[model samples]
Target: MTQVNRPQPPVRIQSSRVAESIAADLRQRILRGTYPEGPLPKQDDLILEYGVSGPSLREALRILEAEGLITVRRGKVGGAYIHPPNWSSAAYALGLAMQGQSVRVHDLAMAIRELEPRCAESCAEREDRLETVVPALEKNIEASEDALGDGAHFTEVSRTFHDVFVDLAANQTLRLVVRSLVAVWTIQEQAWADAMEGEGRYPDIEQQKAVLKAHRAITRLVARGDRNKVGKIATEHLAATQPRVLQFCGDRTIDASSATAMRGFRGLK
Candidate 1:
């Protein structure tokens, strides 16, 4: 038999392991709301707390900062501050990967099609749907009406309605993923708006009215806790609304302008 050798993955250095361990410990404390002790502790204090070298402690803090869990400041007065997790960051990161993949406007539509309607189902399934979900969605509808014919205002409000619709689903993980999807789609919406450039900005009045009507009906279904009905209605509504925006996409690839808008989505989300 001929001798053969198998390649193995590179070993993890001990220093990297120590830094990761410290980062994990700090992340757990932050999530559990047990750290910071009023003001973010000094580096010296953290070094003692983790019993790690200064370099290892600094590396761990850098890791947390990259994960969007903490913000580090540089000054006599500056200390690390805990930042709540942001889906915008996740969405913005996903957008970069999407740009590389030549993702299409239809891809965005499919994502929203699967996600936002399930959110409606979640609202319907919730025990407190009447007291919580119904009122918020009603508010969204009312505001949408107020913004009618005002392209910019209506666009923002409608986005909020979609965001809250998913948010009301009561699953944090689902809310995070869907919220990021919503953020990504907003890039496509802006691309269409820019394509409109000097042409008619807002959709036809009847089209806008139809949107508001569908939202109202979905909210009603949610109030009644009709899960199947809410899900079906929402899926149909988003599917119907998508083609109107697909008209503006360029070659199934995010154009330079739209890609720029996508990169800036963190601020919007």
Candidate 2:
């Protein structure tokens, strides 16, 4: 067999304080559309703009590169380029931000379960207008085929299924909130998966099939405009995963005082 190189681990930021400030500035510019999807300023220019030294600027660039906000290259075309943040990227970033402010992983999961079924119920109401649900349901099934033996893949597909429902709901504000919540939860779930992978404690392969079956049943009810059954089945589908998430977070305690203290570190009250 041909030799394969090990993938390099992501570089760590030596100065989080500097990196975070730079990241905040860059994030604002991007959000404001000042830095559209195009080339970015030279390092020296950014150094002057942010009023930071070379090392601090480079460190910030490294952090943004890791966060998928900017791309750095070398030679004639070398410089950081603005990257348009997608829903997935936004979600992960939001997750990191929330976790930094002490939002627990399982608590995030509970929040999703609370919102998603209602979105599903909405999809059921306008099933004629929405076409994404059935295919998303199918994808959920195919994605779960080997979930018992592959936790990472399973988690990704599961995330997709939940995200699709959020999309199908057709509410821009709700979609934005869901993506923000998912982003924070994704990091926690990744951490959770690391410890739980292959412990033979995952939901069985058949259990996943049942969830998909429920999804399809809900789709059918939605197609028939049976909002009541849609609501009921959506509840059942989500309840399937809620208990496991609760169990995972059972031992992870959060003190309200600590939460309050952390809240002071966040942007909003």
Clashing pairs in 1: none
TM-score of 2: 0.62
What would the C-alpha RMSD of candidate 2 be, to one decimal place?
14.4
TM for candidate 1 is 0.80
TM-score of each: 0.80, 0.62
Query: Per-residue CA lDDT of candidate 2, range 1-269, in tens?
Result: 99999987555444567778988888788878996689887789888888877888888788888877888899997888887776655554565566467766566667777777777777666645346666665666567565645665676556566666667776877777776665455444544555576575666667666756775677667667676777777777767765665677634532223343234223210
lDDT of 1 at 14: 73
lDDT at position 92, candidate 1: 72
Q: Evaluated with TM-score, which candidate comes out highest?
A: 1
